[model samples]
Target: MAATRQALDWPYPPFEIPAELYAAWDARAHGAAAEAAWQRRFDAYAAAHPALAAAFERRMRGELQPALAAQLPALLDAAAARTDAVATRKASQLALDALAPLVPELFGGSADLTGSNLTNFKGCVIAGRDRWGNHLSYGVREFGMAAIMNGIALHGGYIPYGGTFLTFSDYSRNAIRMAALMKQRVIHVFTHDSIGLGEDGPTHQSVEHVPSLRLIPHLDVWRPADALETLVAWAAALQRRDGPSALCLSRQNLPVVTQRAHADGAARGGYVLRDMAGARAVILATGSEVSIALQAQALLADAGVPTRVVSMPSTTVFDRQDAAYQDAVLPPDMPAVAVEAAHPDFWRKYVGRRGRVVGIDRFGESAPAPALYAHFGLTAAHVADAVRAVLGTGAECAA
Candidate 1:
């Protein structure tokens, strides 16, 4: 009948003569007056409870509590001073432990991987039906956890975050996209971020997840090189109020690369960790691959290549930098090599047409991490070889 009506010259013959229908319309027309009456009552209540009203306003504004802001500097300083090798996930937990107690509004949990993800901090009680707690035990539901975090962010009292393996981000991708679209300040901590998470086989390894997450617009993706970088990344995520963030962390321990005194460069997203005068090539790397790049720079230096190493923890942040800073870090004329354990596609932007990328293009193996790295050719030797190859080609063409 609806289809036949659409085909007819007049789709509908308007007729509303029922007294009940007119009464329903009258009630609907008073909705604006009803809302105004409720607003007047709320205003009276707010005036009677000024302190509660102020707190409510602050939460609605998504402002960090003053106490939390005051403690951030000391926490960042403590994180920078730590020099021991540790997993970035562990570093993130330590930072969370210190900050969560100070910042009551920072709430997070893991998708049944708290021990592996290290997302649960000390003094964090599990949330229950009767009362709210700072931490949530999300069980094994990755998608549910992400959606819940998005809800918390959108509602605006808490800075919501959650954790899962990097490989499983595919499950929570749509929710992450929703948070980005709404410009919510949600954080996603993805551990076991690469083939470095070995012995678990190819099913758990994250070969393309990093690049995949980086592709999302307005979402800050960070693959911190070490404990200090992880701390900095966490601080950055908390400060960012306009977008969501993803922190790609590793299961294996990483050596400290940035010191407390020299850690400011990390805030810029990419920094020259080691520089050489009259450098012929620049080596860019993130996460565990950065240590490999440093080693490769040493090898190239010994071979008279004069290479520089730049640690780029956050490509999204780096892209927002001014053209002059970008050019200074990655000179247009210099031959470059990017070393990452993930896919090679995104590295092309910084490395350029003539440059090379040392990355994994296939699934990982079931062996130990060292063996898997060797099997996939993700090592200082491979990165050095790529650098040498690019420089050699440039030299040959010039000759």
Candidate 2:
């Protein structure tokens, strides 16, 4: 084969099959009859179910129905209009309810944490002995669920997503990395995202999972702040075809801090949720801490220090934005303080030299979420102090 390639001066690798084997295989398989037989089977299936065939055709072409896309604004508004705070996981369930029926190609499952993860919707039903269902119940197997989703995605026609606690992602890390490496559109709904999981302690809480997941190339990690952001993240995950997405959701209820008007900017990954005139500093936050950032912004304002609160749900997506947009959201000159219930190192790149990160640098303790937040100094007061300390205008946070 190597000599044949050299003689022909061909850049392509030469076939390695023996002459007899190649001739026999070609004589048996290469013919008009083989092509016609395959076409006949495809035509019979298409004729039997025209609608299903059309849907598969559209999916293969990478086309999302306009009806599905148009439903997003209404979904976002409805979620934003909620009178009380709701967990991002619950909001994710609501999104699945609204979108699942519309997207017949959406296949969902959970790693035996469906109730806690809120991954199921009306359209998702576990398969029975006598019937097929849209959702697979992958019992207590995070790695298996993720690996299976990768296989389903590679097979095409369906968009596969699975759910599990954020901490358990360690079990699925290899498959998640493979999905990113293969540039497959698999969605991982990781709930109970932080120490906010509370009394479950360090075992259930995730202090480094979010940052470690972010480090995976071609993986878009979204830690949405509220229902609106959750809905937008789901839509973004579905629309993104070149890579996988991780939706890290909070276990505790988060107040609606994002505005419906800023939905477009939320889709961009990061945006100024609240901006003050003559702002002197910026507080960057994500997930449940976004509400904390807002409170800190208010405290700073009361202290005669106007500040801007930036809700950065997905830093990976935000980094892909044009320089002008990125700078407009997080000004280079502004002293920044990043607040998250996670590791501190990941925020340093955004906060810069003089900035500080108000985050938990250690394993969580078994306690109520509020107490955990207070103990770790992930409160609005501590965040405000961090901001003030960075601006060189106040004492450092002692927490």
Candidate 3:
């Protein structure tokens, strides 16, 4: 094996020339050798899977972008051009298709956790959920998982996404934060959100994770309320072309919600999920937490609070909303509180000093989610208490 010095034009140190790997010398070399090596690999792949090979070639040259986007041509071809909501739901499919060709480094696998995380990408790999057969698997080692994700993103062209229990996100917090700082497009599929995680116990519940992740600046955290939103969220994260994104999903199957108007859900970030009356207070929530907020709205209504619930999947998007829109969603007359199983840190801006927020703001126990909710104050009663506190009907509780 022959090795050359690092390329002056390139950013990092030189790569090692493996003694036995073919084209190891040119992996870092300039010109024809690199292109030729790619061709050889492509031809071999094409011979084996012609469909994938053709798609891969189109991707290499950048002809597959618009088709991957949920806009005109491809949408028309699919005969779903008029169905914006359905198109939005298909964003994840488009993402996988668009990404399948460009970054071979974009690898994913679940920890016996694919169904929950939505971490499996088609035309990719087949493996036991516990195994790393799909290029890389972090297993249940969430810390290492996040660290490896950071490495892949920092190295470039590799958008690494992985699956994990939402509660386990705490273990990988630092690495996740670093990915945010570096602004890499690493995907994190966090499942089993909230007490909805059921008998899994407080140990598996992710009450604090909601606000903790929202605190990261460059990290676009999206807790999609349903399957379509999940697809859209993944697509939006990929199109970010920069920054890291975390998708918080649920263990429980959420009802599918779609509208023919919001086909570009992924790119747009956030839109009115179901806006009725822009009432006095806006109930902001995400993930499994959103359901709580919706129920609270009805409870508040019978009590005469007259509230509006906003499914704010992306805080980053809500923050970017114009001042008028923000004020409209969250009127000054009606003080609001953010309800989620997580901490309250992420709600300060929206709920404000005058408002209230219902969140975990604490650690977890080894017990189950029901008991944990009792301990952490995440029940419907707790949510109502938060609303009353924010509305000045009750005193503020100590953090």
Which model scores highest in lDDT? 2
Query: Model 2 Cα displacement at 225 (Å)?
Result: 0.7
Query: Per-residue CA lDDT of candidate 1, range 139-236, in tens?
Result: 89999999999999988888999999999999999999999999999999999999888899999999999998999999999999887788889888
Could you list the CA RMSD of all candidates, in the order they appear? 4.1, 4.5, 9.0
lDDT of 3 by residue, 1-399 (tens): 123333433333448445564565545456778898888987998899998777666544423355346453343233323233322223443445545554454578555566556565666765455764444555678888888878866765455787787778888888888888877777887777676667766668776776778888888888776544555576667667558888777666544443445445333555544444545566776655666666666666656555666667778766766877766556667667777777777778777887777777665566555566577665555665567666655542232
Give TM per candidate: 0.89, 0.92, 0.68
Candidate 3 Cα errors over 4 Å, as ranges: 1-64, 71-106, 115-118, 121-123, 127-135, 150-158, 255-278, 365-399
lDDT of 3 at 253: 50
Question: Would you list the C-alpha lDDT of every candidate in the order shown?
Answer: 0.87, 0.91, 0.64
Stretches of candidate 2 exceeding 4 Å from the true structure: 1-17, 23-35, 128-130, 395-399
Residue 307 alpha-carbon offset, candidate 3, angstroms: 1.1
Q: Model 3: which ten-residue window has the lowest total lDDT?
A: 80-89
Question: How well does candidate 1 match the true structure in TM-score terms?
Answer: 0.89
Quote the positional error of residue 17 for candidate 3 in Å. 26
- lDDT per residue as tens, model 2, 150-192: 9988988889999999999999999999999999999999999
Instruction: Give the winner by TM-score.
Output: 2
lDDT of 2 at 202: 94
